[model samples]
Target: RSNKRLVPNIVEPKIRTIEETVPMADRTMEEILQEPTKGYGEAIVILEILAENFEIKTNLLQLVQTNKFHGFERDNPHTHISNFKRMATTLKYRDVPNDAIKLMLFLYSIEGAARIWYEKKPPNSILTWDDLVNKFVNQFFPPSKTTHLKNEISRFTQRFEDTSGEAWEHFKEMLRACPHHGFSELNQIDTFYNGLNEQDQDSLNAAAGGNLLSKTTREALKIIEKNHKFVIQEANRMFLG
Candidate 1:
């Protein structure tokens, strides 16, 4: 028969080993590049994806230590180091390796200063990221400045004239400046809501229709968005009248 050649292919089906059944885990960089990511701003979207992937891929890696940079600012070392610490802390939590952290720090620094600093380093001398951090801190922020920054952070509040969104941003910045401070969530919401303009506050209150203590900052923001439209429409009507 014409099909006789195919019929003699096997007496029984082959049994696959565990290793044979398992799919290959490795993927080419090209394959990853070919995958689509959704968002506005190509650079930002790609960076976000890379950051997320880095977090996942490096989750099991040991914490890699490096020399630290204290920070450098002649007039206000407190502000400089505060920003530096934020970046460093974020990277640490994201599981970034120390060597990469140093590179990132350098990349983020002012172009001319970073270039000069890199060029001035002793030839072939090893400086850890920790060492870099310390050198920066000592060079810029002394003990007195550090104390002052802490006091400033504790006393920070939104100015009465600042917009609700601006007030929220300032509040977040303050929290970042003093993360260990015992500021409660309820207080934070109250502070933000209280700082808003009277009209905006009324809109948020009406939209929420209950004690806003239960709502998160994000939820409050959504209520503002929903109510702000009516406020704007009313203002337009008054202007036309």
Candidate 2:
């Protein structure tokens, strides 16, 4: 399971004094005739996230282990970052610079393809916690997933047996999973309204005083949410029997 060291020690000739560091165009014929010694610049670099000074508190490893990501398709990068932030808040590392602790701890919080992806980023490319998080979520949560979830939201419909409250809650859950779904509140309301069965639409229209569309966006949402709450309340009361 052990991989070969990714970096090898370098030995090079570099005695370029200020006099020798003259511009190529200014060099004499003898200097211009010299062969190139250092073939090409490096294509890889060590992570800047690891370059900063940091002291990992004893508890950080325990917290990181509890929420490690293994690069599975089902893994949620957003939720992982959210939980990591909460765990980091409880960490007590004195003298460490702000954001350094989170950057350091984030390394131990992933493995497999996730770790490889992090290690492969350009050095100094990740300057702050937000930068790192944006890259991570984009890589793991991908645009394809967002499109699929948005389609689901656009086609949301109440089931034959489920109550209006349950259908509303389910639609909300889909929205939560795709935070970048890009649908506005009005579009969401219109889509859901059009998707519902005739009876439910009539019921909502009645609840909204004959015309849900006549209400403001906020008013229409409130009317729908109120119905959801009313259904929930009535369902809870059924246990009393």
Q: What's the CA error at residue 137 for candidate 1, in Å?
A: 4.1
- Among all windows of 10 consecutive residues in model 2, the one with the lowest summed lDDT is 5-14
Please name the candidate that would achieve the greatest TM-score relative to the true structure: 2
Residue 119 in candidate 2, Cα distance off native in Å: 5.3
RMSD of each: 19.6, 11.3
lDDT of model 1 at position 208: 87
Model 1 weakest 10-residue run by lDDT: 38-47
Counted clashes in each candidate structure: 20, 0
Q: What's the lDDT of the predicted structure labeled candidate 1?
A: 0.45
Q: What TM-score should be assigned to candidate 1? A: 0.37
State TM-scores per candidate: 0.37, 0.68
Q: What is the lDDT of residue 43 in candidate 2?
A: 18
Across 105-134, the per-residue lDDT of candidate 2 in tens digits comes to 676688898877865675335656778888
Model 2 has how many clashing residue pairs?
A: 0
